[model samples]
Target: MDKVFLVAVGIGILSRIIMLNTDQRQYPAQPNILLSQLVLAFVASSLGALLVPALRDRAYTSITFLSLAAEQFRQVRENRRDSLQNLEDIQLVKRGEAFIEEIARTYEIRNYMCIITSLSTIGLYYLIIEELKIAKNTSLMISSIIGLALTLILKKLLKRESIGDIADVEIVKISFVDECIMKVGDLKGITNIGLKSDRERYLSRGIGIEIIPKDKDYTNAGILFDSGQRQTIVYNLYSRLGLYREHDEPAFVPLPRRNPKKESLIIAFIPMEKDEQKIIEAVKSCPVLASAKGKNLSLENYKIGKKGSV
Candidate 1:
């Protein structure tokens, strides 16, 4: 796609240079020179039109990438902001994505209009020049400038919609051990965690685990296992099945087993409001606790290995 655009632009430039030289050589004698210049300008403008859609697509792709990167950074820094502020950031990014998509669609329309308008206008100007035999260099130059100025104005108008402000979200620090523990779940295996603002009706849940060795010092050993049964549980609770947002990707990390000696896992949860009924339902569904018959130990006791073996 990019190569094709470059080739078109090169051809347009070459045509314009040829037309310019010819016009200068035949100046003040041939009115056809004005028509030729208009044709070259129209060709150049049509070629330039391809850039609009390409730039719009590029901007949309960039925003999606940056938003995910910001989410990952927020996790690494352990930054925690108020629930409302976090919600606002999510909403803002959603709006920004939609705006970018709209801009791309509009550019598609504008590309079509530019091709048609340039061809039609050039044809009209050519007829006028040939019939009137007028040396209208001033008029042609003014029209060309006006057309380019309008394109620049439209580009600026879209720029405003594309630029968005990122809201500050809080981060909470936890030790590697704590990160692992929070990731562990009951026999039925469920780990509840996500942004505080996302727990509107139910807490987002996943299978949790912990990273080991901690070589990079980038993040604690906290990891959430999101697969099979646990992933479906999250989908049902959040009502966002299949449509995962970019911000959601950073909520979990991969914790592949690095060593056999480490027996403990640590996990952390961002405190948030959760639906009691959903929590109860999820707890009831856990396999380890499901058949305990009111004999389950406290979460702290379970974490410290004080309870009987599973």
Candidate 2:
């Protein structure tokens, strides 16, 4: 039982580490943040590993510890949210409330993943050893395999739908309307710039993109029109290609607007690298946030209801 517990805890920690991916987003990049996550992983794993043995011993009181773990995970979500919110003032492109909440919820859910992996591993070991009467060493090997396989499956399940999944992104030209108002592609009335210098910089260096939703019923259009989703897309692009503007330069800030009639989204911004392909790719790669997922209004029932109402 002791050996089984150790193996379960080790597998749980490994699962957490596997899921703690640091990409271009660079979240959990700081050493302290990384260390804190690992420590919580350890705690979550240990708690999970103890559950099988405690129940076998009829220690029902041990279940209370799981409740404590839930409380701790909730606190982790709050802490993550507070930390990100505090950094908002300093960020050139702020992550909106929807993005922040999504990130916090993700961190909380990951700790629970640790618990689940650990529990599954230890529970399997007991089943093989006590019921099937398998050899201890063989049971350990089989349980470890199962735990790691489950982790990989969960990782695949966690893969999010990117903007590319729902829309087609095209590189467009940044043009001016009436000299001062900037237009992305042919979609006009995006923003107004008073300074000629700003206008010149924009025309010379800015990248414009048009995102056209593929869904004929306009489900993807609804997603693109969300204010929070648009902000998240801008933030993803800014983070990847880097923004050309500074804190004081409001004229250069990236702006995204929707063409409601066409069911498309447009944005123009000056990138630090000035790579049009990179900008397009970044926009396509932006994850469609959970909070901003479009409703299935295209359902036959909904369409019938709309027609009836009209």
Best by lDDT: 2
State the weakest 10-residue window (summed lDDT) of model 2: 300-309
* lDDT (tens digit, per residue) of candidate 1 on 113-142: 344333333433344455766555643444
Pick the TM-score winner. Answer: 2
Q: How accurate is candidate 2 locally (lDDT)?
A: 0.84
Per-candidate TM equals 0.25, 0.92
Query: Per-residue alpha-carbon lDDT of model 2 for 204-299, expressed as tens digits?
Result: 888888998874335677788888899999998888888888899999888888876566898887888988788888888888888877464654
* Candidate 2 vs. true structure, TM-score: 0.92
Which pairs clash in the backbone of model 2?
none
- What stretches of model 2 exceed 4 Å from their correct place? 22-28, 296-310
